[model samples]
Target: MGYQAFYCCYKTDEVVSPEEACEMDLNIAGDRILELLQGDDDFFGLIDEHDTTLQFIRNGDLIWMEIPIPDQKGSFGKHIPIDEVGPLIAGLPSRIDLNDFSEMRFQSW
Candidate 1:
């Protein structure tokens, strides 16, 4: 059996794995995204229960997400930019956007 990696977007009601979820302490995933957004804490701080969108950008392409904002309600993920990714995990953006590469043949998992 082969494990397949998929690029997925989730809404408020959707469920995700532990690894797929963002960290609350702004250490890992959350911190990475914050750096990409140029340290604009307002973007993350302004979020309320009504804001349910979280955007993820991999590579130079845009990924429109629909996941629920961790502690927020009724809010869905939205569009994020790739330039916001930091060097620590910059490759993740490219990996996630592998599907957009015309020269590469993607195999499931």
Candidate 2:
């Protein structure tokens, strides 16, 4: 199977349903997300067709990425430097697999 995913920005609700999410133009959402990083702990989430999820959590002054592990009902998280968000999102493709970011994750659940 090929990679497929949908996105949701808690503040904008840009993609609230599968029927319309359509691989959510990450380029646009990434930019929007970057701009949403205020002190509030807002969240941006990506859930693939397979039910795997990646959550971007905004903290006091930085961001953290949470990727779920379905098999163990656990998750892994990675701290994201505010300055590196642009480059990181820019390097991403429309579809992604968690395994590819193993080096950036640490067990969180």
Tens-place lDDT per residue, model 2, 1-109, is 3223344555664444434444545566567567655445666665555656666767767788777786766677788777776566656654557767876655635
Per residue, candidate 1 scores C-alpha lDDT tens digits across 38-76 of: 322222221213332233433235433333324433334
- Cα lDDT of all candidates, in order? 0.32, 0.61
TM-score of each: 0.25, 0.66
lDDT for predicted candidate 1 compared with the true structure: 0.32
- Write down the RMSD of all candidates, one decimal each: 15.8, 3.9
| Deviating ranges (above 4 Å) for candidate 1 | 1-16, 19-25, 30-60, 69-75, 85-109
- Find the candidate with the highest TM-score and give its number: 2
Q: Residue 47 lDDT in model 1?
A: 20
